[model samples]
Target: MPEFSDELCARLREAFQRTRYDADGVLEALGAAAHAALGRGEPELAFRVSRYAGELGTLIRLFLLGGSEPSAEVEAALAPVTIEDALAVGLLRADGESLAAGLDIRPHGDEQGEWWVISDLDSDLLGGEVPPEHVLGVGHASLSLIRATIRRPVGTLLDLGTGCGVQALHGARHARRVTATDVSARALALADATFRLNGLDVELARGEWFAPVARRRFDQIVCNPPFVVGPPRVDYTYRDSGLAGDDASALVVRQLPAFLTEGGVGQLLASWLHVDGEDWADRVTRWLPPRADAWFVQRDVADPGLYVGTWLRDAGIDPRSPEGRAKASAWLDWFADNKVQGVGFGFVTLRRAEVAHPTIVCEDLRHAFDDPLGPEAGGWLDRVAWLREHGDDLLATRFRVPATVLLETVAGPGEEGWETTIRRLHRTDGPGWQHELDELATALLAGCRGALPLSDLLELLSFAHGDSVEELQDAALPMVRELVRHGMLEAA
Candidate 1:
C-alpha cells in the first residue's frame, strides 16, 4: 500500500480507538478515501470507487441510526464516531492466509451491533478466493444498493456473499435478526471481524450460496454474490460460481423466488454476459420470479476482448508482469474465439409484486440510482407491470379513451411549435399539428374508453392514422411511465 494510504488507514484506526465515530466526519473521511482510491487510476480501484458512489445510501441510513455518529472535534465539542462516514476507511485488510486456512466468522459480538468473531484474514478470511489486487476491498456499488433500495423495516435479512459482513452489519439496524453467509469460511471470518469492529451483532454462516440458509426464509435478502461469468478458480469463489459461466447470475436469479416471502425483497449486485445467441433483455426476462416483479437495468456492456481483459487485470494477471503475458494471452484468446459480444453489469431489485398476471418488462437504463425515483420504490416496482395488467381494461372502458382526441406526431417537427404529424401533413415551418379525424376514425373507437392497451394502442392508431402503433407506443410509454411512476396517472 502507498505510504499516504497507510497513514490514512492509521488515522481511521485512531479515530475508532477514541470511539469518535463522528457522523459527518466519518462520511467525509470515507468519501475522501473513495476519491483517493479512484485517484490511483487502477482498474479495480476505479470499479470500487464507482461502486462506493452508488452505495452512499447505505451510509446515510447508518448515520441516522445510532450505530454511527458524526466524527467529533474538541473544538466543536459535539462530534462522535459514525459508521457511515467511515465506510470504506474502517475496512481492515483481510488475512489471505487465514481465509484459506478455514477460519469462519464466529460469534463474539453483541449479536445486534456490538461484537463479532473471525480468524485472521491470512489464514481463512478469503479462503483462497482472491479478488483482483486492484479491488483491494469490496466494490462500493454493492454497499450502495443495500443502502438505496432498502426502505421498509425488515425483520430478518440475509447477506449473501457476505465478504466482510458490511451488509450484515448494516442490515442489523432494521432487521431483528441479520445473517451473513458465504461459501468461504474465510469470508465469513472477515465479516465477523468487520461486525465486531463495528460493534454489530449478526449471525455468520459458512456454506455455498443459498445452501446454508436453505431451510430458513427471511423478510429481506441482500446479496453481493459472485455473479461474474466464466469458470471458478481457487480464489474465484468470491465471484465465479462453479456453475457455467454467466449461468452463475442466472442461478441466483432463479433461486431468489424460493427464498423470498410472498412480498419480500431481494437486492443484488450482479454481472451477466451478452451471449452469442440472444438479447440480454430476453436472457434475463427468463429469470423473473414466477410471482415476483423485477426492475432490471443494463448500465453498460463491454465486448469479449474488453470483458476478458477486464477480469484478467482484476485477478492481478498483468500481461506485462514477468510471468503474466503468456497466461493472460491464452485467456484473452478464449473469449474472442467464443464470440462473446459483451458483459453487462448493474444492480437489480426484486419484489414479490402480488398481481394475478406474470409480466416481464426490461429496459436499458444507464443513470444515477437517484434518477427521480421517489421516496417509495415500491411504485417503480409495481408500475413496471401495471400497463399490461390494466391496459386491456382501460381499452375496454369506452369512457377511458376518447375517439375525438387528435392524432399528432411527437417529433415530426419542421414547424417550431407544431406536432410532427401536423408538420408532416402541412410541411409546417417548425412544427405542425394535424387533426387526423380520419386517423382517429379507427383508433379512437379501439381505445376510446381505454380498452386499447398501450401495446394495441399503436395498432389502433395505425388503422385510423398514418403512423404505426409501434412508433406511438415507443414514444408514449416513456412519457406516460414517468407520469405513472410519479403518481401523476392512476392505473385506468
Candidate 2:
C-alpha cells in the first residue's frame, strides 16, 4: 500500500493541476482516436501519440499507459513534488535510469468534478496474475453502481466494501457525512489517499462486511460487493468473499436492513445462482427483511460454462492454460454438485419502510435504458409509498397520465381498409416500459387527466360501454395500480 500523508497528497494534486493531467486534458493531448483506444486497454496509440507531447503526455504515459520515462522528464513532469518525495510515497520506482509507476493513479470525474483515484497496478500491465490482496481500480461494476445510486442529498451515507473509494467519492457529493468500510487494509490505505488527493473528508473503517459499522444506521447505502459465486476459496480480495455459492451476495442482502435507518434506501450489485427446479426470484426475495420494499433487475444470465470462463478471464487467467483448465474443472464440478444451472447478474434496490405487505419485485430487465436510473429508483419508492397510502380507497384518488407516456396504435390491412390490430402504451423515459392496452383500459387512461376520480371514470366508462360498474371496477383497479407503480400515472 502507498504511504498516505497530507503533504504528499497535496503535492501530487498540485503536480496534476500544473501538468493538466485530467480527463479532458488527456483527451486533448492524445486526440480522439488514441484516447478512445486507451479506454479499450490498447495503449499502443497512446504511447505513439504521447512520444512528443511534453509534460502532460509524459505523466499519462508513466501513470496510465504503464510505461517508463527518463528520470529528468519525470522530475520535470512532477514539478513542485520532488523525485525523492514521490519515491518515498511509493508513487514511482527507479527502473535503471527510468522511473516507473509504483501505483496506478488516474483522473476520474463525474458531474461533481474531476478527482484522482489510486489503486494497484493492473494485472495485464504487470504481465502476471494479480496478487491475492490486490486492490482494484474503476471498472464496469463500480461505474454501474455509481450511475444507479440515488443522488438525493442525505444526512448520512455508507459505502460498504469501498474498493479504491470510487463510490465513496460520488457519495461525498450528496451526503453530509460519508463512511466507507473495507476488509483489506491495503484497500483502505489506497482509498484514504484517493480521498485526500481530492480534498474530501470521509471516515474509513477496516473490517469484513458490516463488522466495522455494527449498530450504525445511515440514510443511504451503496455497495458493489464481492458477488462472484464459486467453490469456497479466495484468490483475489477484490472479487472473492471466500464464501460458497453466491452466499456473499445473499449475506449482504439479508443483513442490509439492519444498517439502514427507517425509510432509508440501499443499492447494490449482486449475482445469484439459478439452481435446477428452483425459481431464482423466490430464492432472492426470501433474503429480504419483512416490511421492506425491494426491486431486483436482472441484467444478464450466463450458463455455468460461460460464468466460470468470464470470472477466470477477469482474474487475468487464460481459461485454456493448464492451471486455468484445472481451476475451471474444479469450479464446474462444484456447480454441477450443487445443481446450479446458471448465474444472474443484476442491481438490487431496497428500502426500509413500515407497511403490512412490502412491495417486492424481481424481474429480468435486459434491455438497455439511455437515461440514468437514479431518478427511476427514487420515483419507484415514492410511487410505492403513494400506493400504500391509497390502497384502501384507490377508486377515490384522481390520477393524471405523465407527459412522457405515449399511446401507439398498430394497424394492418384487413379485407377492406387498414384496421387497428394492437394498441400499446409506451413510456419514453426511464426504462421505456411498454404495456399492451385493450379498448376499455385505453379509454380509462385517456380519461385520466386528473379531471375526476378513478371511480367516477370507471362508472362513466361502464355506462358508455354498456358494462356493469362492479365488473369494470374489478378489472380496472389492478391496471391502474400497475400504471401508477411504473410512473405512467400519478395521483393528482
Candidate 3:
C-alpha cells in the first residue's frame, strides 16, 4: 500500500496546476486527432502530439502513456516536487536514471471544475490481466451514473461502490455531506488519495454493498454497482460481485428502500438478465421495494454470445488466444444452463414515495438524449408526483406547451399533390422525446398556450367534432396525461 501524505499531495497539486495538466489543456495539447485516438486507447498518436507540449506533454507520457522519462526531465516537469517526493506519494517510481508512473493519475472534471483522480494502471499499462483487487479510475459507466443522477441539493448522500471516488466528488457539489463506500480496501485507499488531491472531504467506509451503511438512510444515493452478470467466480473487484447471474444488481435494488428516506431518490447504472417467457419490465418492477416509484430505461441488450465476447474483451482477454476461447466457452455454457436469453444494460432511478404502489415507468429508451440529465430527471419526478395527486382534475387544469417542445410536420408528394402525412411533437431538451400526434390531438395541443383550461379547449374541440364532452374527455384524458407525463405541456 502507498503512504498518504498531505505535504506530498499539496506539492503534487501545485506542480499539476503549474504545468496546466488539465482536461482542456490536455485536449489542446493532443489536438482533435490525437485526443480521439486516445479515447480509443491507441495512445501512439497522443504520444506523438504530447512530444511538443513541454512539461504537460512530459507528464502525460509519464502518467497516461505509461512511459518513463529521464530523472532530470521528470524533476524539471514537476519542479518543486522532487523524484523522491513523487515516490513518497506513490505516483512515480525511480527506474535507474528515469522516473515512471507507479499508477495512472489523470485530470478529470465537469463544467463545475477540474480535479485529479488516481487508480491502478489499466491492463495496457500493466501488460497483463488486471488483478482481482484492481481499483478503476474514472470510466464511462461512472460518468453515465453522474450524468443520470439528479443533483438536487440534499442533506446527505451516499456513493456506493465508489471506486476512486469519482461519483463522490460529483455528489459533493450538491450534497452537504458525502459518504463513499467500497468493498475493496485497496479501492478505498485510492479513493482516500483522490479525495485528498481534490481537497474534498468525504466520509470513507469499507464494506460490501450496503453492509457499511446498514440501518442508515440517506437523502440521496448514487451507485454504479458491480452489476456485470456472469459466472459465480469473480475476478475484478471493481466490476464483479462474485454472485450468480444478475444477483448483485438484484441485491442492490432490494436494499434501496432500506437506505432511502421518504421522498429520497436513488440513481443506479446496472444490468439485468432476461429469460424466456418473462417480460423485462415485470422482472425489474418486481425487484422494486414498496412505496418506491421507479423509472427504468433499458438502453441496450445483447445476446449470450455477444455479452460474453464484450466482457471478455473488457477483462483484457484476447479472443484469438486459446485461453480466451476456453473462457468464452465456459461463459457460454453457464449462460445456457441459466437460461439467460439476453442481458439488458440501463439506468434505473428510484424515488421513495410516500404512497403505496408507487408509480413505475419501465420502458426501452434507447435513443440518444441531451447530456446532464439531472434537471430533466428531477423535473420528471416532480411531474409524476403531481400527476399522481391531480390526475382526476387534469381536465380543469390549464397547461402551456413548454418552450422546448417543437411540432414537426412531414408532407409527401402523392399522386394528386403534396399532402400532409405525419405530425410529431418533440422535446428539444433532455431525452428529446418524440411523439406522433393524431389530427384532433394536434389541434387540441396547438391551443394549449395557457390561455384556457384544458376542459375548455376540449369542449371547443368536442363542439367542432360534434362529440359529447364526456366522450371526448374519456377519449383524450389518457393522451393528455401521457403528454403531461413526458413534459410536452406544463401545468399552468
lDDT of each: 0.53, 0.92, 0.87
Query: Taking the tens digit of each residue's C-alpha lDDT, what string does model 2 give over 229-289?
Result: 9998999999999999999999999999888999999999999999999999999998887
In model 1, the runs with Cα more than 4 Å from the true position are: 1-23, 26-136, 232-234, 353-356, 367-377, 384-488
Task: For each candidate, give its TM-score against the true structure.
Answer: 0.61, 0.97, 0.95
In candidate 2 the C-alpha lDDT for residue 459 amounts to 91
Candidate 2: deviation at residue 170, Å?
0.4
Question: Rank order by lDDT, top first?
Answer: 2, 3, 1
Candidate 1 lDDT score at position 352: 68
Off by over 4 Å in 3: 94-97, 411-421
Each model's RMSD to truth, in Å?
Answer: 11.4, 1.5, 2.0
Worst 10 residues of 2 by lDDT: 1-10
Error of 2 at 266 (Å): 0.9
Q: Give per-residue CA lDDT, model 3, range 367-476, as digits (tens).
A: 87766667767888988989999988998899899999999999999999987799999998888888898788898898899989999999999989888988888878
| Residues 415-473, model 1: lDDT tens digits | 67644342112212111112222334334333534444455655656676677766765
Looking at model 2, the pairs that clash are none
- Residue 29, candidate 2: Cα error in Å is 1.3
> Which should have the higher lDDT, number 1 or number 2?
2
